[model samples]
Target: MVSLIIFSILSLDTILNVPELKNAHYGICFLDLKNDSIIYDYNSEKLFVPASNMKIITTAASFYFLGKEFRYKTNFYLRGTIKDRKLYGDIILQGGGDPYFNLENLERFADKIISMGINEITGGLLIIDDYFTDERLPAGWSWHYLDAKYAPEISALSFNKNVVSVRMRPTNAGELANVYIYPSTGYVKLINRMTTTTNSENIIIYRKPEENTIIVDGMINIKNARDIDVAVKDPAMFAGEYLKERLNARNIKVSNPVARIRTYELFLRQKQPVLIDSVLSPNLLEIIKETNTESENLYAEILLKTLGAYRYKEGSFNAGLNAVKEFLNICRVDTQNISLWDGSGLSKHNLISPAVLIAVLKFIYNSNLYYDFYNSLPQPGKGTLKARFNGFSDTLRAKTGALQASSCLSGYIKINGQDYAFSMLFNNFVCPIKKIMQIQERIIRAFYEEMRRTNVDNTELLKPVEVIQQ
Candidate 1:
C-alpha cells in the first residue's frame, strides 16, 4: 500500500507537473490529521481560482460566527390601520436576508391576512429591500450568468431564489415555440424566437444586460414542456408581484396593485422594520448542508450576507466578505494568499491556495464543530457528487467545484480510523473538465491506499517520510 501511494504521487506529479503552469495550475496538499504533519504537498501555496469550493470558507465562517441553530427572520408589517376588515394602510414585507424565502411563504402570509378578516387591502404592497442597496449583485459576476439560475441578484428580500421560471414547449411542430414566464408579471418581458424542429436541440437563453427583458430563441424537439429558471432583474419587485397575485387569487382586493421596492431605512439609523408576522428560515446547520452538499450558490451567498448583517449590522456583499476575512484571521488561518470576492465563489476573481484550504480543515477538525461541518460536506455518491467517485463513495467525503476550464475537489478522508484532509485544485486546464476530475479521482485513490499503510506503520512505530518536489 505504501509503494502504491508513492507510485501514485509520482504518477500525478508527472501528469500534473507541466511546464510553468501557463496553460494550467495544479495545487495539491494532504495532511495527516492525527499527527498534524504533511503527508504530501505540491505547489500547495500557489493561488488558484477556487470556484464554488470557496463555500468551504464561507461555511466555516458561518459556523464559527453564526451558530448551527441560527435562524433568519423576515418580518411582515401592516403599515396602516384596519377599519371594519378594510386595511387603510400599506402591507410592508420587510426582508431579513432570508435566502430561501419562497412563493409558498408569501402565499401563507396572504392566507394569514385573509384569516384576519381583512378582505380588502386598500393599500399597496411595499417590499423593503433596504438591507442591501441596488448594488446587490456582486462585482465580479459575469454578465451572462445574471440570466441563468446559478447567479441570482443578491438582495435582503430575495424570494423564490429571485428567479423567474420560464415554461416553454413545442407548438404544432412548425410554429414558434410557446413561451410563458411564471408568477406572471411585468417584472420580466420575454421575446420568443424559438421554433419547433426535428434536428438536434440548440437552446440559448440570453438576458438584456441591466434590464428586465429576456430573449428565448432556440430549437426544441417535439412535444416537450420544459421549465428553465432565470434570475430576475429585481427581487423586491418579483416578491411584491407574486404576493399580489396570490392575494388577488384569494379575493383580497388591493386598491393599489403596483409592486413597490424601497431602499429607505425602515425607521432608525438601522432599518427598524416593525414585526407583524414572519417566516423563519431553516437553521444554519441545514442551510450549510445545502450550501456545501448541493453546492447551492444562493444559500452560501445569503449566508455570507447574513453573516455581514449579524456581525456588522449591515447585509451588503462587502460587509459579508470583510466578516469572512476577519473570521479566517481569528482562526489563525493565513489570509495573505486568499482573495475572497463573493461568498458563492462563482466570481472568477476569488483566489485561494490548497494549503489555505487544509489549514481551515485543521481548524474545523480540532473544534467542537467537527461533526456538523464534516457531515455538511457532500459525501461520496451524494448531493452534488451523487454520480461521482463510483466505487470509493463510502470512503470519501469532499466538496467538488468547477468553473469553465478550472476544477477543484477538497475535503477530508478517513482511512483505518485515521483522518486526513486534502485539497486538489486545477486552474486553466486545456483538456476537458471531466479529464481533470478523472485525474483527481485516481490521485485520491492512491492517497487512500497509501495512507492505510502509514496508519499501520504508525502503530508499529517507524513511518517513512518522503517529500516530492514538483
Candidate 2:
C-alpha cells in the first residue's frame, strides 16, 4: 500500500495555489474533460503574451477548416512559345505557400522542366506570387528575431524556408576557416574574419539589414561541428535563383540568369501563362505533425494564410485572422479577450488567456477529429518532447511556446482515467528557461503522483473517490 504522507504531497492547493507561484507571474486553468468541471483555476481569466502557444489556436483552426488531406500546390507556367525545341518566353513559377518546399523539391521542379524537352530559355524566369499579401514579416515581430533563422520572411513562394545554411571549418589550428553555402549561390556575400584556434567555437554570422551581405566576426575552434543557418532577405528571389542554377546544370540555358518576382499589377494584367505542371505537397496530417511536434513557425503561417485565402479569397494576415475569429465564434470561445497578430506567436503582441485555450481544447475533445488532433500534439517522449519530459506520463500531450521572457505550455493530461485540459503560462521570468521548465515538469509530476495515490483498480470501489465528491 502507498504511504499516507502521499496525501500531504498530493493536495492541489499545495502544488498550484501557493505563494512562490504567486510571484511567478503565471496563469493556469485545469478542467476535467469528462465532467466539464473545473479541477483547478488561478487567474485563468487574466491575459498574457502567449508566444508560440498561439499555435494551438491556429492549429485547431487548420485541422478543422483545412481538413486532414489538405495539400498545397505550386504551379509552373510557361509564357513562351516552343519552336524547333527552343522556348522564347519567360517561365512563370507560382507558389501556393507550401512550407516544406525544400531544395529537393526545387531540384524536382527543375528536372520536370528539363523533361519537357526544352533546352533553352530566351527570357528570364518570372515568379508570380500574388497568392499572399505584400507583407513579408508580421507586424510587431521584434527586430532581434528579424535576422534569426527562426524568423525568416513568410511568403507564398519561399524556398528552403528562406534560410541560407553556411558551414565553416578551420583548415589548421591558427588559420582562417573555410566557408561553404548550400545550393552554391553567390547571392549572399560571406565576410570571413574568424580565426581558427584551440579555443571553443564561437564563430557567428550577423546579417546587415536591407543588404545581402553578412559579416562573420568571432573566433572558431578547429573542430567546427555545426552549420550556421541565417535568414535570407528575399526568399522568392533566392528560390528563383536556385531553380535557375538547377536548370542550367541540366543543360537548360536561362538567358537572363536571374530570377525575380513579377509585379502584382503586371501579373494581374498579363495573359495567363501556359500550364506546364503543378506540384502538390504532402498531406495535411503530416503537416500537422510537423507544425505541432516541431513547432514550425513557417508551416503555421502558411496554414494561416491558406485559411484566409480559402475563406476570404485573399491570403492577407488580417483575412486569415478574421477566418480564425469566425471559427472561434463557432466554437463559442469568446473573442473579447483574445488578441492575436501572428499565427506562430512569434510576435509578442499576441495575448490570450488560459481559459480560452482550455475552452478550445474541450471543444475539440467533443469532436470526431479528436484522434488526429490528440496525436498531433507533442507527447512527453515524442517529437520536441523526446529529450524533454522523458519518463513522465505518456498521457501528457501538449504544445510548448517561448519568446524572450515569456513561456507557455497547454494541452491535455489523463489522470485516473479522466481526461483534463490544462494551460500554464509564465511571463517576465528573469531566471533561465530550463529552470522554468523544471518547475512546469515538477507540477505535472505532482499531478501524476497524486492521481497514482488515489488510483483504484477495483470496479466496485470506482465511486470515483475524489471525482465523486465533485
Candidate 3:
C-alpha cells in the first residue's frame, strides 16, 4: 500500500520523479493568470503527442476566425416552377457544412416543402456537397480507426454525425444473435454471423472501406447485449438517402432518385435555382463548447473545415490547417515547435509543446473571447472530467485527452480564489494509464494543497521536496 505524509511538501517535480513516470515522455506548464507568470515548468519546450489536447488550439483558432455568432446555413432551392400543386423543378439540397444536421432538421425541411403545397416533384433531388473537398478522411488518421464512430467521414452534408448504431441481442447458446440497426435506414447492409455462446463475450464489428457492407462476426455471451456504433462509408450519400426517405414519408412524391453534383456541374445546367427554405445550425460558440467539453472529434474537424471554407473559400484539410496556422501566428505562438496534421488529434503526427498550449490558453485568457472560451472547458464532475477531480467541482475546469499511450490534461484550476492555467502532457508511456492519471491528479492536488496554505511563505511553498521512489 502507498503511504502519504500530510506535512511533507509536494510539487510537480517531486510528483513526476516517481517510478510511475520514469519512462514517459512528458511536458508541463503552470501559468498564473493574474500576473502572467510561469509558476512551474518541466520539459515545457519539448514536443509531445497532444491527443485531444489539440482541441484547445482548434477551439481558440475557431473563435478567432469564426465568431461566437457564426452558424452554418443549409439552404433548399427549386430549379423548376410549381403549377397545380405539382412542382416541375428539381429540389436542390445545398450543404453548408452543418455538422449538427440531423433527422429532425430533415423532417423540418420536408414539412416546409409540404407547406409550399408541393405534392409531386418532377425532377430528381440534387445534392450539392461541393462546399468541402471530396476527401472524407483527413491525413495521418490510422487505417484501423476508419470504421470507428469517432473517426466518421467528414462531408459538407452529414446526417446523424455520419454514424449508425448496431444493437446486438443474445438469445440462447449456439444460436445466432439478433442484430438491429438504428435510424432504420437502408443506407447500409449488414451480414450478421454473430453467435450466442455460453462463454465470455467476444464481438467484432467491421465495415469494409468505401463500401456499405458491415460484417458482424463473433461470439457473445448469453447474458450480455452489445451495441456498436460504426461510421458510414459515405456521408453525403447517406444524407441524400435519408432525406429522400424523410420526404417520401411525408407523402411527397419524388419522381427520380437523388443525384449528387458539384457546384461546377450545377452552374453548367444554365437554370437558375430559386431559394425555398433553409436550416441553420447552432452558433459557433455552442458547437465549440460541445467540441471542447466532450472532446468530440467530429465537431473539431467540421469547425476546421468551416474555417477553411470561410478563409480560403475552400473547405479542405490543408486550407483549414492554414487558417489555424494563421491564427496561431496572431497568438504569437512558436509555430516552429508544433506539427499539426489534423484538427482532431486522432493523428499521431500532431506534436505540440506544453509552452505552445500555455501560449494559446494565455492568448484566450487575454482576448475578448475569454469568457466564452473559458466556459467551454468542462469543470470537475462534468463532461470528460465527469469521473475525475472529485470534490473539486467549481474550482477546476479542464480538458482531458487520451490516445493509446498518450494522455493529457489542460485548463484552469483555482487556488485560494486565484485562477491559474496549466497543461500536463504524457506520451509514449509503458505504464498503465490509470497510474499516469493518478500521478497527474497528485500533481494537481500538490499545487492545490501547497498554494492554498495561508500561513506558508510563497517561496517555501514553491520549493520541491525529495520523493523516495518505490
Q: Which stretches of candidate 3 lie over 4 Å from their true place?
A: 1-10, 264-271, 455-457, 464-470
Worst 10 residues of 1 by lDDT: 1-10
The local distance difference test score of each candidate is 0.82, 0.79, 0.86
Off by over 4 Å in 1: 1-23, 257-275, 458-470
Report the lDDT tens digits of candidate 1 across residue range 1-470. 13312112444555555443457888898887889877677778889999988999999999999999998888887766788999886788878778889878998899888987998888688778777655767889987677889988887888989888888888777779988988787768999999888777778787888788989988888756789998887787778887887888899988886655554634533324455689999999999999999898888888888888888988888899989989888777677767889999899999989988898899999999989999999987889888788876666789899998789999998888888899999998787888888788888887776666654543233233443444
Point out the higher-scoring one by lDDT: 2 or 3: 3
lDDT of 1 at 356: 83
Candidate 2 ranges beyond 4 A from true positions: 1-12, 16-22, 257-272, 455-470
TM-score of 1: 0.91
Instruction: Estimate, for each residue in 134-221, the C-alpha lDDT of model 3 and write its tens digit.
Output: 9988999999989999999998988899999999999889999998788878888899999999998889899998798889999999
**Model 2: worst 10 consecutive residues (lDDT sum):** 461-470
Q: Write out the backbone clash pairs for model 1.
A: 80-89
Which lDDT tens digits does candidate 2 get at residues 415-452?
A: 66878888989887777777777777777777666556
Record all residue pairs in model 3 with backbone atoms less than 3 Å apart, i.e. clashing: 80-89
Quote each prediction's TM-score: 0.91, 0.90, 0.93
lDDT of 3: 0.86
